[model samples]
Target: MRAKNSFLLLAVILLSGCFVSKDTPKKEAKEDPYEINNQQDNRSLADVLRKYSSLTIQGDGNNARIYIRGQSTISLETQPLFIVNNTNMGRNYAAVNSSINANEIVSVRILRSLSETAIYGEEGNHGVIIIKTKNANK
Candidate 1:
């Protein structure tokens, strides 16, 4: 009887230790509106931007359009903080990203609300279009 009791106690302790108090990381209270992951370049852009193509994405495999708002422009020298792979993308980044390299993008996220705009400060006055690539790596 004592051996059985001891074995039961030991099992209980072992099982108790294995259980974690946390429940699914407690789920964040609230996520930031603009708190986004590192924008990747995993898009399927097969066609390059040609003449006067309205800002259209994820349409056909051809005719990709690169988006750039005026507020993102800085001192006429640098454009908006084009962030990609955590690296500030240059103007060429759009050219390269939109070029018919691999495939067209899957989708584009436009953040215009003050909640989203406030993060970028004045730089996002014109608005912000977060480009998410289709197949690009992080």
Candidate 2:
């Protein structure tokens, strides 16, 4: 009778384990890019990105390719458009961002939505990272 009771108990425990819930609510992922104000250290662009969110910065130094959340392009070029002040830096946008001193920057705004980036035409498809410097001509 003792052996039978132990067997039944073991069976019950095994059955209960099958019904246990493994689906726990996960934390809501932040889709928006964080804004950094009062620019302090002249840290590298990749460093600034790493400090804010869980971004994937592939490559070295200022030449790194930054991948923003939910931003993907059909073309081979996955890099986002880097706009300084009111002027677009064209193809070498990433280079421009790396060369600029972080201390000289006043504000960094990220335009993620399709509507927000639509104004710039196809170039804005990937996403628009607008960096305003302290001396930017408004």
Candidate 3:
């Protein structure tokens, strides 16, 4: 009889917690770039992203993770259009990371709004961060 009562009591407590949830809506565990806020103190561009994000941020002088907003537009039927120095930067954008010289960069800007990504179309689904670099001659 004691074992039965104990089990019943445990179940009641468990069920009660489900009915009495807090103010925040329950969210499933998932990756969210929004988890990292830019409001924190200024560290080097590389340090800021490397600290908060789960991904490894590797390179030289400076690096950044720009968080622009996702878009609903899906105009491109095939692949993404990645522009580098005003030209198409090819499909393997991630691979090109190693090729980027951090010392040549000026500053990186992050845009976290849907309006900001709409211009780029659907490739900016999670967001699009356009990286602007200094001219090689400079």
Candidate 4:
């Protein structure tokens, strides 16, 4: 009876170790800042621009024209200048739309304020869409 009771106690101890408490805390999954959540792999730069509240996109796809909402343009050109990885892509939206891949984009920033876009000179008079890609050196 004594040996049987000792074996039962050892079995209970081993079983208890296998079970986890329901109140135990779980580690939460961390979100990546550069990640564009719920976006498709084939998403275009125009699709990504729609996510931002400060800008407005007219039309669709390659022919799409982007404008800074609530910001007055100094020039007749409504299209904002595109700066990709510190390179001036001019005001042509079709060229930029085709050249850049949405998956390679790290971040997209809009320089709407005059003070913010003054560094780019006359080209930035309307606004600036600064695109930082994963491979900036490329």
Candidate 5:
């Protein structure tokens, strides 16, 4: 009777161990490029571009030239195509630099790969700097 009771208790303990809950490891969420951060306030568009490892900025301020590291300039235009709020601002860096403030930008995306820039056609060949302003719809 003592041995049977001990065996029953052991079986219950083993069964309870098997029924224990296990925590499932969670998958990390991917970072979104378009997600605007509150920390970017009062910053210039050029300052934001500097954060990217694939980009190279030459000169300073209004004369600043942005270049994608691996891409070669196929035409006389050295600057990349600037698209602000879906409007093509051409290859003129000054127009984009002077018009848009850093604080006004909701998101800044650089399309360097041919596959990514192909949608913009020939103008995006050198690469493309797409800026989404807070008042994009306005």
Candidate 6:
């Protein structure tokens, strides 16, 4: 009877460790509004951008039109400005992303708000997407 009681006590002790106490902190997932990390190589830039709720990608490949969720501009040009390697690639997001080889891309940074887009002036009134390519120096 003592052996059975000992075994039961051991089991209870082991099981008690598995339960999480209320005092134990829970982890929360933080949202990144600037850049979306793409680990999967199977998907294209447009496909990856589509995963973000803030970005709306229309068309495909070089013809794709990228738009921000809440645009405050009066002009019909809802397309966000694309900047590649510190140079402005105009308002064609598709051309900018498609022109560069996927392997050459290092990271894509997005500036959505007017304050963030202020550097480009009226050109960036809509929004801005900066695509950085891997340099031979690095």
Query: Against the unseen true structure, what C-alpha lDDT does each candidate score?
Result: 0.46, 0.71, 0.46, 0.86, 0.83, 0.76
- Model 4 weakest 10-residue run by lDDT: 31-40
Error of 2 at 2 (Å): 54
Runs with alpha carbons beyond 4 Å of true place in candidate 5: 1-25
1-138: candidate 5 lDDT, tens digit per residue: 999999999999889877635685677898786655758556666787788877898876788888877888656776788999999999888778899887777788888899999998998898898889888999
List of clashing residue pairs for candidate 5: none
Q: Tell me how candidate 6 scores on lDDT.
A: 0.76
RMSD of each: 12.8, 8.1, 11.3, 10.6, 6.8, 8.5
- Counting clashing residue pairs in each candidate, in order, gives 13, 0, 1, 0, 0, 0
> Using Cα atoms with residue i matched to residue i, what is each candidate's TM-score against the true structure?
0.34, 0.63, 0.38, 0.70, 0.73, 0.65
Clashes of 3: 1
Q: Supply the TM-score for candidate 2.
A: 0.63
- Model 2 lDDT per residue over 26-122, tens place: 7798654444554467576666555544345777575777766787666798777788888897546467766677767666777778999999888
- In terms of lDDT, the poorest run of 10 residues in model 3 is 62-71
| lDDT for position 10 in model 5 | 97
Candidate number that wins on TM-score, 1 or 2: 2
Give me the overall lDDT of model 5: 0.83
Candidate 1 lDDT over 11-105, as tens digits, reads 99999988877664776688544333334455343232211133333344433334433333445543333444334344443454544233333
Could you give the candidate ranking by TM-score, starting with the highest? 5, 4, 6, 2, 3, 1
Superior by TM-score: candidate 2 or candidate 4: 4
Q: Across residues 50-93, which tens digit of lDDT does each residue of candidate 6 receive?
A: 76678888887777778888886677888888887788889976
Candidate 4 lDDT for residue 116 = 95
